[model samples]
Target: MLYDRIGVGYAHGRRTDPRWLAPIVAALGDARTVLDVGAGTGSYEPLDRTVVAVEPSAEMIRQRPPGAAPVLRAVAEALPVRSGAVDAVLALLTVHHWPDWRLGLAELRRVAPLRVVLAYDTRRHADFWLVREYVPEIARLELSRPSAEQIAEELGADEVVPLPVPWDFADGVFPAHWRRPRAYLDERVRRSCSALAQAPPAAVERGMARLRADLDSGRWEREHADLLAAPEWDAGFRLLVSRR
Candidate 1:
């Protein structure tokens, strides 16, 4: 319901970054049949696999390209598929949005022997320049969701792989624009990030005003000069893989 409102233009900024694809596909391994839970716009769905998607937002589902995976309107806590129906289940950057992430993890475990989740460590992500300096409220909001470690523990994960955000990462998620500060100034980019979209408007407005002033006055550049030389930084994203 929340996404149906904010997800209107999701496809515009939520394209897949190839850097993430290699690791995700590798985690999937030999799984021929894959279930993509909370699959928004069908990004990162392997084209060679037999993929079925489950998404709650009609707006997001509608934006799926014409030949993308067939999807069912369903929640992660209640997947429609039978037990062990697929070789693997993929939940990408969507677990935080679930009302009950524990129940959703249970459902993911029930449906497949292999589970792959893309999640973040709230503490680390909260330190990002955008969240730390600009929108501190987003950090408070992140505190309410399960962290990457917690999700990995619940899923009995075999591995928790760090996913460093490349400077030019294509996906416009919250931390994707760490190097490109200007990206956050765009209203459309902010709308695509659920954290920015859901954060209090007054807080966001105040933060943006300060950010704009800093950018115009060259203060941002002077403060974050070190970041400009880095090719990638860990924005706390992790790929949790469970093999049962």
Candidate 2:
């Protein structure tokens, strides 16, 4: 499915979570040159580095910060940079949208000198209240996105470090809001989410209604009260710091 208006609102909701940022940043491993593939609105591009970004979306490119990389209107499968020009390559929450997976991975491998960092959610955790009760279609949408293991192997890494980062919606961010459950009810927050942001009107209505009912009936609390006190959830957001 094509990206919807969420691309416009993405900067608001899909922020650069610091916990997630640490791993992606550290994965670059002292690299000075970087390429942000599918750099949506320059949300996660790092400063103080020689960086370039590739994106085909015009609106997204327009949203780039004043100092962000000189974005080229290019697809990930076909990059404009010469081989080995960048020391690091990063793609956040975007690989899933690529129509061709292997070609994109091949492109990254050809250009990146050392590291390729990524953050993705592939597992459709039906157990997640947001997924289970509210928007199960997202789980189905994720099936098109390649798995992290596949990405690791594509980058030719013999070892992949899978770090578990959990977000509790109640923490007021990340995993914190999940424990609160009410965050998902907000239309603004939902608009920030690409999955629901792209959903059909009927599907969004149905999903939100179910989620509201669950929250009101205390079913959400009863089922996940134990998690409410807990700090975070293993949301399948991971860092794949692939090294040559």
Cα lDDT computed for each candidate against the true fold: 0.93, 0.69
Clashes of each: 0, 11
In the range 1-244, model 2's lDDT, one tens digit per residue, is 2443446655566655566566667778799989999987776677778888888887677767787788888899999989988888887767767889778878888898665556445663434567666666666766666877677667675445554445432112222366666786777677666666766768778987887898889887888878767655666655666666
- Give model 1 RMSD, 1 decimal: 0.8
Clashing pairs in 1: none
Question: Per-residue CA lDDT of candidate 1, range 1-244, in tens?
Answer: 9889999888999998889999999999999999999998999999998999999999999999999999999999999989999999999999998999999999999999999999999888777789899999998888888999999998899999999999999999888888899889999999999999999999999999999999999999999999999999998899999996
**Model 2 TM:** 0.87
Candidate with maximal lDDT: 1
Give residue 50's lDDT in candidate 1 (0 to 100). Answer: 99
Off by over 4 Å in 1: none
